[model samples]
Target: MTATAHETVRDAGRALGIPDPVTEAFVRLLRPCVYPCLYEQLPEESRKHAGPAARAGGSAHLPVDVVVPAYVPHLVTVDCAAIPTDVLDIDFPADGHVAILAEITDQDAGFAIHVPAGTETVERRPRETEPDALKPCASFPL
Candidate 1:
């Protein structure tokens, strides 16, 4: 039996240590905008680079930045990052238009997703409060 493009993506996500929920969300969100064939052709090396960062968050619901190499046709080497739904403030099953945030230059267009620290509900609370939470530790006398 042949694996569908979606399955390939899921497998890739698994190999990268991305949580199942985030991977499923990515597959569902990008299904309409991205071609199926592209998912099948996702490079192995790029997946390696993205895996560590994706898993660094350690939460299934946290938004992930999936950077696909040559995402746009004829734009080889210019990767595009897929923005997760949470970052865009979109709800599931809504069928809303997805946006790809890109930096376009004369030579190339590079897309990226920036999820600031402490933005997600799970990460909002600090694991351990410092003596001076508001100020940097370095600012105080040793």
Candidate 2:
């Protein structure tokens, strides 16, 4: 079964034009990082779905924020110092998007961060719900 899953992943990676070695390396990295992050939320028996599933659960759990830094040369800052140190920063490369899953309680409403895209900016909307605009695809399930 393990071998079959590995083959499935490898085949999918190949179909997407990723080399076998790179795909293997990514699988190695995600295996260690992804589970531990989810585990931090709760014990195994009481565990809900991680990543997007948790985000879809709405007010019952934390909201997942996807931060996509522009490709042009500039800085896109995300400061979470006001929040607890444990949930401070989400590490993502400048060229990639990072998913930040945070648990909001009744005592605290939400935190603010200023995300700038070059010289232009957009108005802020409700943070909890996904926008009504057209989506490229349905949520990417892990």
Candidate 3:
């Protein structure tokens, strides 16, 4: 079976004698490679701007499978809350693009849907910018 990104990197770390923290940092930096779908699925309004960073209250952490076309697939966790107003005003796009976390069979493959199965439609809410708003929203059991 194909290894998870963490396992793949960890194996490389062991072979190269890289520290755990360094390997982890590398993984984090490379994590966004899977999110190209985010840009593609962005509301037309948000596509023209740079993607926003994860921030408190405005971001929801969901285990998503982002598949940028023609790239290696990713099964990384991402925060979908609090898109910057300057970037995009919406958080999770109501557009059906997120994939079902449980039904995701190919962790290393791209998902086709915008929203996956088993997710409730979240109510539209205003952004939360408080520093303390950085708590975990809903976490997928997967």
Please name the candidate that would achieve the greatest TM-score relative to the true structure: 2
Instruction: Report every candidate's CA lDDT.
Output: 0.36, 0.36, 0.41
Q: Give a tens-digit lDDT track for model 2, residues 1-142.
A: 2467678888999999999999898766543122222335566665554332211111111123534222111111222222223422354233212223232335432322333223233322234354532222222222
Give the Å error, residue 77, model 3: 24
lDDT of 3 at 12: 92
In the range 3-52, model 1's lDDT, one tens digit per residue, is 38679899999999999999989877663332222322457765443421
lDDT of model 3 at position 18? 94
Residue 51 lDDT in model 3?
A: 58
- TM-score of every candidate: 0.23, 0.24, 0.23
lDDT for model 2 comes to 0.36
RMSD value for candidate 3: 16.4
Off by over 4 Å in 3: 1-3, 34-142
For candidate 3, write residues 5-114 as lDDT tens digits.
56988899979999999987877655223233444556798667645432222222232443223222223333333322233324455332343222234654443334
**Judged by lDDT against the true structure, how good is candidate 3?**
0.41
Cα deviation at 9, candidate 2, in Å, is: 0.6
15, model 1: CA deviation in Å? 0.6
Backbone clashes in each candidate structure, one number apiece?
Answer: 0, 0, 16
Of the two candidates 1 and 2, the one with more favorable TM-score, higher being better, is: 2
